[model samples]
Target: MAYQQQQHYQTQQPMPTMGMQVGGGNRNAAGKPLDSNGKREWSHGLCGCFEECGTCCYACWCPCIVHGKNKQRINHLAAKGSPDPDGGACCSGSCWGHCLLTSFLGAGWILQCINRGETRGRYGIEGGGCGDCCTSLCCHSCDLVQVSREIELEEKSFGQRY
Candidate 1:
């Protein structure tokens, strides 16, 4: 009796690559194309607070409120489908949290740094975590103003009034 040899075949799945393009070119979180270096620059500089006097004043006088609004706007932009029911309320829980942290622990810079990092990630801005923390710690109000301006500009580009 002759026995036939049997062979088992295995299929290899392709591994997912980093920065994979879905349609055409590499796009950031806001659906904008990346530069040749694969990163985007901030719409406004950190020291450009005076560019929007109202925003600067708002950020200076009521930073927590501005933080809340900026957080809400970033969340809305990231979600990109339904509008936030809170409508980016300035007195949201985040505002209270920031106020409490700043008033009590003097640690609001931690939260601000996190939000700054998030904003950078969402817009694909070029920066490092260290820089974000430093900016939030040293230039807190400026960072808030910059992030707010960036979000507002993004919203305007998308034809949405902030």
Candidate 2:
């Protein structure tokens, strides 16, 4: 019996590269593209708070209202879908509870500080001016006003852009 020798050749194929995009091109938490103008990407300078009289007044008198509104917006943006049924209640309760609790005891800046930290964490903002708590403690109203402005502007920009 004679066995015939057979040779098999293997063909090489190039592997496909992932080609993942970097920097994600400035996407929001919901994976949506932010406005190219970048108007809503970051907070305005804290010193500019007085330039917007309306925001300053609102933040001054009823920080809870501003904070609650900002919180709601942030939550909404993060959710990026049907609004949460308990969104209003949760925001109201948390804002009121924290604001009242912090204020009555002369520590009103605490909540703002925490919220500032949260904003920074969400938006990838760098901390500045002796840390969140100190910055908020020193410029509590400005912080609240600035945060409110940022979220409001961002939501509006989102609507306009998409």
Candidate 3:
């Protein structure tokens, strides 16, 4: 009876083969496969802003422009091949909003935090809301550049897929 029971239990369990997508296979919005934990690190670190001097300068001098461009890219990716609702404009409402908020309320970090969180979630980036808020509040310019680089990398990878 014990031998028969062991055979039955072993037959009921099937092992996953190599390259098999177990648990329906987790993927990010860009359709990239994720690890077992369903998370990945950022392509660039916050302090690596100098890696892209032009982008770093742009973000430092005119953050609104970089913010707008980043938003447009994210929207384009989210929309896949569809038309972007923001019309892919660099000076869209989001950019203006960031500018106005920073110019007046000095609370532009709020919008930055929101955008960062959204980007992290879409890319399955390993981060939490608290970290996002702190990064946006403390290293505003670096955060923008980091996100810009990440979106650019994602676009490159996504483009190759099709």
Per-candidate TM equals 0.75, 0.63, 0.72
Poorest lDDT segment (10 consecutive residues) of candidate 1: 21-30
Report, for all candidates in order, the number of backbone clashes: 0, 0, 0
Best by lDDT: 1
Predictions: Cα RMSD each: 5.7, 8.9, 7.7
- TM-score of the candidate numbered 2? 0.63
Q: Model 1, which residues run further than 4 Å from truth? A: 1-36, 82-87
- The collision pairs in model 2 are none
**In candidate 1, which residue pairs clash?**
none
| Higher-ranked by TM-score: 2 or 3 | 3
Q: Stretches of candidate 3 above 4 Å error?
A: 1-36, 81-88, 158-162
Candidate 2 error regions (>4 Å) = 1-42, 81-91, 128-130, 160-162
Give the winner by TM-score.
1
User: Which scores higher on lDDT, 1 or 2?
Assistant: 1
Candidate 3 lDDT over residue span 1-162, tens digit each: 455544444456677443443332222323444567867777678999999899899888888888888888777767663324453477889899999999999888888898999988866789899999999999999999998877766555433421
